[model samples]
Target: MAVNRDKKEPVIEVQDICKTYFMPGGMSQSVLKHVSFDVMPGEFVAIMGHSGSGKSTLMNILGCLDRPTSGVYKLAGKSVSDKTDAELAEIRGREIGFVFQNFNLLMKRTIADNVSLPLIYQGVSEAERHERAVQMLHKVQLNGYEDRLPTQISGGMQQRVAIARALINNPKIIFADEPTGNLDSKTSDEIMDLFTALNKQGITIVLVTHEDDVADYAERMIKIGDGRKVYDGLRAEYQKDEE
Candidate 1:
């Protein structure tokens, strides 16, 4: 389904966002420079940049993992730019889901345990956590493998477990950073297909990748260069305009 940009309010609003890191000797390096954009509900957006282009920094700000040095960031319409670390953690728990490139799972833990890990922080009971984990595994097509350890699964299946874990919180938005970085081409395609299915179900996805093929999965693209936004529009149109 197409996103209606006019009628519904954006799920993410970033205005003139900027980030800088200060060195010990009063030296500083600016990362993102006055970047801004909005992502409507259910929109599949990809953020792209080469290394040192600040895409990861942008993702950190959007995911509430880090605060911007300056500028406004609103998630679900409320400004989160000034929220405290604790407040941001709460918001992240309640509103954002993250899937990392490394598939950050506990090696010794069972698949179900890993998927249910997020709920432990929310004070959810063990029984319910297992139940929800099973449900999420089923959603990711990993139903019967819940008892297996992460070491027992293929790289692709492990990523599925990561996706299941991300879904356990029923987040308003999902941030997938280089989600297919370790997978083979076929597995990457499968994972992107899953993301596409989820987006069709009205889940907002913000993906960050440097690969053109990976970025192609998203309907819209936001490209950054030298800490500045160089492009924002339909993914297909970006190169066409450059050409």
Candidate 2:
């Protein structure tokens, strides 16, 4: 299905976002400072920064795992910055998928069970959940592994299982944070290739990474420096500028 990009609203919108943590003795630290960006439907964007540059904090906000101290955040055209925790959880479950650096699969569960875990929260029937899990596993090319455990698979395969689980909900967007951090170079390339294929299918992707090679997989790059957005533009252009 082709997405009409011009007619669709942005999937993510952040304006003048800021986050601060108050410390003991009347001190505070600002992690994000007036950062702003928009991610259109079907767009693939990579957020990059060194440690302590606030990229992780920004990702947490973007993924609805945390809220900014100040500023507006709109997800799929709805203001979410002020939403209650329950509301944010509902939104996260319904509209967003997450792929983390660690696979985050249950070690004791079957691959199919791990993939279908989200559906249990939605009160889906076990049979239907299993069916959908099978379908998602197929989508990730993990056929015939549904009955296996995460420990039985390679790191790359475990990541594939995680991706399949993310897709089981059919979210409008996926937030991947250092998705290839645990893999070897070749495996990392394979995982990035999978992400690229998913992006081509019109699923919006927001990835956070510090590695230039991983960021290269995205078309656009948003670079942060010391709590502020330092650059935002074509990934290739950013590389050229660096060169």
Among all candidates shown, the one with the greatest lDDT: 1
Tens-digit lDDT string for candidate 2 (1-243): 998856877889999999998999999999999999999998889998888999889988998999999999999999998899999999989998999999999999999999999999999999999999999999889999999999999999999999999998899999998999999999999999999999999899999998889999999999999999999999988854561
**Model 2 bad stretches (over 4 Å):** 1-5, 240-243
Scored by TM-score, the top model is: 1
Task: Tell me the spans in candidate 1 whose CA falls farther than 4 Å from its real position.
Answer: 1-6, 240-243
* Model 2 weakest lDDT span, ten residues long: 234-243
Q: State the displacement of the C-alpha of residue 87, model 1, in Å, after optimal TM-score superposition.
A: 1.0
- lDDT by residue for model 1 over 1-243, one digit each (tens)? 997757888999999999999999999999999999999999999998888899889999999999999999999999998889999999999998899999999999999999999999989999999999999999999999999999999999999999999999998799999999999989999999999988998889999998889999999999999999999999988773462
